[model samples]
Target: MSGYLFAILAAAACVAAFAGVYRARAIGAVATTGPLKAHSRPIYHGLNAAIWTAVPAFVVLLLWLAFQNSIIDQFVIGAVPGSETMESSARSLMTSEIRQVAAGNIFRQPTPEVQAAADHLRSLQAVSTYLLVAVTLAIAAIGAFLGMKVVSARYRARHSVETAVTIFMMFSSLVAIIITLGIIGSLVFEAMHFFAKVPVTEFIFGLRWEPQIAIRADQVAGQGAFGVLPVLYGTFLISGIAMLVAVPTGILSAIYLAEYAHPRFRAVVKPLLEILAGVPTVVYGFFAVLTVAPAIRAIGTAIGIPSSPNSALATGLVMGVMIIPFISSLSDDAFSAVPRAMRDGSLALGATKGETIRKVLLPAALPGIIGGVLLALSRAVGETMIVVMAAGLIAKITANPFDAVTTVTVQIVTLLIGDSEFDNPKTLAAFALGLVLFIVTLILNLIALRTVRKYREKY
Candidate 1:
């Protein structure tokens, strides 16, 4: 029933958008009379109207939908007898049961104390949903009507709509900025708490990393080392291997695809490469563990090297393969963005194709290539699944690529896996690791940005 109502609302919105567009066009067509001309094409006025109708109502609907549940819960709780005496946790559970019951599904009845509260919640939800639907429809109608009214003689609808759109776009850009700030703030706050409990020097410089600190006195080995050296070493080692494999393979593939491959070949091959990116990391994890790790171990044994079954090489190699599409796609864009004039001039100078490409094309596209590599590197660093599957859980401080090693991401996952306390050093340490990873990626991105900017200026 709710779905039917939502579908009706959506269909109405679409019709309103189309009607607004058609009305704007009709008004523009009528207004092209003697001596009073509009600034834009009729279609532009129509599109302006449609956008005004859709965007604002779409935004309002989203905001309302997001907050409606909390509002309904508050109202329902207030209406129930003695509900003011209920604990927040009890209230939360009662609300969950209320939602299930409202959906016409049987839920385990709430405790006797909250039974009346649950019943109240169901009624509130129905009322809230009806009210939300009406309000949303009303807003959409208002926006569409206002847009239609403005589509007349002497009305600069195109300019007005464009100004509104620019403001909306600015707000959209701030969403990403706000999210990033929120993440950084959370990481910093948790990391500060972790550092307060465990000394900063010990966490940073100590050579060991055993984060098992028991809160109870009876537990054996209460205090554990918080050394990040092992994790950092493993992180660097795996990332180094990933870069080693990814850079050459990715750049070469990109060069071939962008510069050498025929259009038909590109059409077939590009989609295949993108498909590689689409494969989930967990699926890659299984492949890395089952296929790559074993293959590496077998090959190593045949040769002189004693490769650990959970070698960093296996994780890195698979991660590199996983990130190949990221690098290739970005590099292709970068190469494509290089100006034709530069390539033509080099070719005109009697330079061979290879010589022109090396001297002119690659240099012109170097910044983009570097940016792609950095972005791919960031992906590699943050990747958890491939490492978790192929790399050992034991954080070993080692330089050997053939040995078992663990990364910061893997450690973070382990620290907070299950049955964890936020205050426990083990769980808290994950935030610290997360913070370090964040900072490292931030630095790489900044460098990439600067490099790209420098190259753009030169070009």
Candidate 2:
């Protein structure tokens, strides 16, 4: 029914737009032959009418939808016998049952009063929807009339439309900012709970990464180690290995596609390369577990290297493959953003193509390339599934890529898995890890932004 209201509102807006256009055209018809016609175009007047007709109706519909269910639940509970004495939680559960029954999802026999309450709930909803439709349509019609009435030869509809657009853009940006703050606030709040029990220094600088807390006094683990260093070390090691594999290949491919490939070939190959990015991380995880892990283990065994079944090398390599498009696509855009004049002038100076690319184009695009690498590095750092499947679950300080090591993301998931008491450090530890990861990503983004500013300066 809400969707139907949207469709109706849209249709009314279209009709209103046409009416406004007709009214404006009629008003300006006499002045067309004169020096000054309408101050704003008929299209702007039409848009103004559409906005007036849709916005109030949309707002009313949203408010109605948001509040109607709660109102219904309150009224129905009050009307139902024996509901008044129930606890708040009981009332909530009863509300759920009533809604399920009203929605035709009844699993068992209901009392006569419940059946009647369901009927009452349905009837109220129907009446509310009908009233909503009537009220909104009336408002829209009045708005359309007012909008068209204002459409005179001297009216400034274009200014009004531009102001509305600017306001909308500001609102969108405000919403994004609020949501970002909310996420960071939540991470910090939960992380505070973690730090209350465990000292900050122990969590941050300690070398061990065992997060399991003993449930009983006699448990050999006692208070399990909460050191985050091993986890941080593994994360950086995997990310470092991934960056090593990704950087050269991605940048080279970008250079090839941007500078050397035929247009048609570039179009085809670039999309194919980007297709790798579209592949799910879980799918990559499966590929790592089934294919890459075994291959690495075989190579290690043949070369007299001791390799774990689940090795960081396999996870890092696959993760590198996954993020190739991030670097490649961004690098391509960066190279394309570089002035063709620079390339042409370098060639004019008798520099070879290779020399021109190395000395001229590469330097020009370096900032953007760095920005892309940093973004990709952040992406590689945050990835969970690939590392979860390919890399071993043990968090320990290790330099060998073939040795099993777990990352911060993996630890977060492991710590939070199954039933966990929120007050316990084991569960709270996830939030601490999350806060660290969030800070890392934030720093990366800031660096990326700084590089972008530098790139803009060059252009």
Candidate 3:
């Protein structure tokens, strides 16, 4: 039934879009006679009409789809005797579970009330689909008819269409900005709640590292400790090690691509770098655990240094490999953004290519390069899978990269991965951690933007 409704909606949308296009083109052809005719071509006019016809109807269809399931479930729950005794949301869940069972997705038999509710829901769905299809088709047909009628000699279709398209583009850009602000707003609210429970000073400045809390009100071993020192230490350790591996390797690769490597080498290298980015982090995590950790351990033992099976070194090194493409790609763009004249001027003044690059190009691209590094660092800080799988989950405050350590992201994942009560502070703590991570990344991005702007002004 859902599939049938979707098919009808799709057909209606296509019809509306094609109708709008036809109307706009006919208007363009007729309206060319009068003085001050619109500048845009007939096809543009047609495209504008087609977009308008599709947009509103498709929006309506989406809204209908979103509400349909809830409305049907509510109706079914309301019909069932004693359903009102259950909480409204719980009743909805029960109804949905029964529906699943009735549809043969589950083996368990539902009670009489649940079975009745499921039957009612199926009936409601059938009725809703019929109504939705009727409404959508009616709207599409009306819109198409109106559009065809509006195509006349006096109508200025082209100008109107272009203006609408420009407005649409601006609106599209605003949606992205609005969504970013929304996420930040949500983060702020949760962080504020966390700060209320755990003092900001302790979270920010405490020296200890523990996140254990009593699950039951009576059982008490470790509770009320919210120190973040270990998590911060782990973050810095892993990030620092990653940078140590990534920076030199990435910079050399960028230099080769920009200054030394032939076009042939570059053609192969760029795609391979992109392929590195495409590889899933989970796959990299496996590689780190199976390959890198054992190798690091062997080397450590041979050199008379004790190394844990789950050391920061392994995770950090693998993370660095993951970040290499990010650094190299961004660095390549930064280098490319440096004007050719600057390098040519230095070389013409008797400087070697290396000297010119070192003195002129590097300085010019420094700000952008820093921005890229900060971006990569932000990613490292938030990275969960690599650290979770390779770096041990034990939160320990340590400076040694060869020791087991954990990060904020790892804790957040551990805290929220399984079933937990909604009201539990442990679960809520994940939101607080998320909020902190969001703010840190946001600040880093703003700093990078400012740095780049300053650099541009200088150059």
The TM-scores, one per candidate, come to: 0.84, 0.88, 0.84
The ten-residue window of minimal lDDT in model 2 covers 450-459
Order by TM-score, highest first: 2, 3, 1
Model 2, which residues run further than 4 Å from truth?
A: 33-36, 71-91, 101-127, 213-223, 415-423, 449-457
| lDDT at residue 154 of model 1 (Cα atoms) | 67
Question: C-alpha displacement of 166 in model 3, angstroms?
Answer: 3.8
Count clashing residue pairs per candidate: 0, 0, 0
lDDT of 3 by residue, 1-459 (tens): 546756765665566556656665565565676564545554554555555555566667789999987777777777888776888678768876877965768667678777777777777778887887777667756665665565555555677676877888998999999998898887677777777777888877777656666868776665656677777788879988998988888877888898898999999988898688788999999999999999988888888888889889999999999988888888888898988888888888999988988888887888768867886887789899989889988877766667789988999888877777646556667777777677667787898788777665246
Residue range with the least summed lDDT across 10 consecutive positions in model 1 = 109-118
1-459: candidate 1 lDDT, tens digit per residue: 445655655675567557666776676677676577666665555666666566666777678778977887788667767767989998777677766665657656555545665577777767877786787667767777776677765677668767877998898899989998999999999999999899999998989988898778887787888999899899988888889888888888888988889999999998898798899999989998999999999988888787898999999998888888888888888889888888888888899878987887777788778878887888888888888888988887776677899889889988988988798777899999999888878787888888777665357
Q: In model 2, how large is the Cα lDDT of residue 192? A: 99
- Clash list (residue pairs), candidate 2: none
Candidate 2 lDDT score at position 101 = 91
What is residue 311's positional error in candidate 1, in angstroms? 0.5
lDDT of 3: 0.77
Which candidate leads in TM-score? 2
Candidate 3 backbone collisions, by pair: none
